[model samples]
Target: AQSVAQPEDQVNVAEGNPLTVKCTYSVSGNPYLFWYVQYPNRGLQFLLKYITGDNLVKGSYGFEAEFNKSQTSFHLKKPSALVSDSALYFCAVRDGDWGSSNTGKLIFGQGTTLQVKP
Candidate 1:
């Protein structure tokens, strides 16, 4: 029943400009959110997470996310984006349905392509 949504199919930003990839989640209980980035021909790399604590959580590649409990959102942001940063990004949440046997699984969003143009 829980789901994560990346409303945009693609996000375009000029190289050196700030970039953002939107993410919103719907689930029961405290949300365990995560962000991942994937370059072409490369596997998804863990970017950041929002399991608990402060609203803002920092991660790899100069990226960070603000966990907004009121908005049910955890959008990924980078102050400045590079051409190399262009890639597919995903937002996911830990499936906490312990009742089910498949625990520790992450329910991911549809994914958003980030295009940083020089």
Candidate 2:
């Protein structure tokens, strides 16, 4: 079965400093990884995805993620973080094949809280 894990329950970073939210995935076939962020009163917003092509995938709000096939990891990163960037982050994985039985069903990791201090 496919699964995702965000080992860290929370990540702390200072304003203007680099920040990372870790994510690792396990899947039977090719892995489709994604990152999402949720604000206090908003829905889960797509951050980035690794379906194919380059290992490094860039997404919204200055966020980027590198898909490490060897490590099965897709950690979200930003060179500089803002206090406003603080939110709940999620890592998700889907089967590489779209025709699979669980099509469009993503296995999500435990939520991780990102706290950015001003």
C-alpha TM-scores of all predictions: 0.93, 0.95
Model 1 per-residue lDDT tens digits across residues 1-117: 789999999999999999989999998867889999888899999999998899999999899998898999999999999999989999999755456574677899999999999
RMSD of 2: 1.2
How far out, in Å, is residue 24 in model 1? 0.2
- Candidates' C-alpha lDDT: 0.92, 0.94
| Prediction 2 global C-alpha lDDT | 0.94
For all candidates, the clash counts are 0, 0
lDDT of 2 by residue, 2-116 (tens): 8899999999999999999999999989999999999999999999899999999999999999999999899999999999999999999998866746558889999899999
After aligning candidate 2 to the native by TM-score, how far in Å is the CA of 102 from where it should be? 5.7
- For all predictions, the C-alpha RMSD in Å is 1.8, 1.2
